[model samples]
Target: MVGNPDEPHCVSHLHPETAMDQIIPFDPERMIWGSAPALIYLEIAVRVGVIWIWTIVLLRWVGGRSISQMSVVEFLLVIALGSAVGDPMFQADVPLLYGMLTILLVVLADKAVDHAFRYWTTAKRLVDGRPTEILREGHLSHAGLDKKGIGPTEVMEMLRRAGVRNLGQVEYAYMEPSGTVSTFLYDQPRPGLTIVPPLELRRLPAPDALSGACCTSCGLVRATADGTCAECGATEVTRAERLESREISSA
Candidate 1:
């Protein structure tokens, strides 16, 4: 027959076990329908139903960002849910209805929170919380930072990562629900290479400037103010200030 050569029936069964082979003979009662074939099938159906319903409901309530923004408690809940579902999925004795009920309870609880978040402003603010306004009108708000349990140093580090040296560069800044500090640059834009001002040499650092130049292999250019390159294990190697300066001047 013109059919799959690798099909189960297409392969020949070995005659018997050899001296080198270790075989565990199959029990027809255990391998085939077993004692609870009907229940086994029912378990499959229930697990599938729970998984399908929960997947959609969870996504709706938790939101797309939950995958990225899951907190410690949220992560533990996810792990527990997986374990709770596993027993019902594999065991034939466990009623599928019980498993489905558990899943439904979680889904209902999630939906309640989702509804509150959408309809009740106070409830939403209490649970989902609001983004911390870190900067306003180019000024860093110390009160905002303090409220979010973040320090000035951390804010500065975040700003530096956002390619901004001074607070004035940012028109607005907020600590996102995902724990990332989001920055909104002013009309001038943060002084860096961006899509609108592609290939701008203004931000290029001078050869003598420690922050601008980096090692070719490791890209560790910035060191301490004491003149030490800690990044690439090369203390003597300085930035290509002359090249950068020339390029910027020409630009």
Candidate 2:
């Protein structure tokens, strides 16, 4: 056969044995050896077990960081899961069918757990924990702080992120199951409040003089300078301003 000196032997397929070698070589060393069934299963079990423990520990440790840590865990999960799958794919004696089966089993178990979380309250608590009240009525919940392993500084940070400059402005603050701080403000905010931001306002006293104030104790929309709140009889109030509803509507 005539061929270029620089190119491979293109006519090698013309030889009987050459054609057979190109398709399925007689060299069993490259693709021979059946793995033990028990060993293969054991390997799969170990891989899945390690991955499971890794996932649990990672979430639990970083969960205190809340929203910031969620993205980190999710991003790392992709790399970890890919590594888990690659081992079974490249192992010479491991069967592709077995690898796929293990993956399916994991998926099914995950789905089952999700179902339990949705339907069972106890299961949800075990997995996601309960919403702990960290602050209420301008007072810190000591038990909540201890249970969540958080201090005043962390609480302030969470509040700032939520656009709250003052803790007195918040009625209730909860550490939610999803590792987020949820804040609820009072109905009427006090005016010229003595309490400032970053500090936990322990005791809230009734207002003596109201100049542009809202009754946080009651739903008082209007602020009066001379008298107590007409709606809730609350003397203590915060600064009150009319919310322009040009862009949105309540009813």
lDDT of each: 0.51, 0.56
> How do the residues 39-108 of candidate 1 rate in per-residue lDDT, one tens digit apiece?
6666655664566446545543553234446632244347546765776676554555555655665556
TM-score of each: 0.41, 0.53
Superposed Cα deviation of residue 100, candidate 1 (Å) = 3.3
Model 2 per-residue lDDT at 188 = 48
Let me know the TM-score candidate 2 reaches against the reference structure.
0.53
Candidate 1 overall lDDT versus native: 0.51
For model 2, how many clashes? 10
Off by over 4 Å in 1: 1-80, 87-98, 137-139, 188-251
Distance from true location, Cα of 210 in model 1, Å? 22
Which residue segments of model 2 deviate by more than 4 Å? 1-34, 46-58, 61-82, 86-99, 190-251
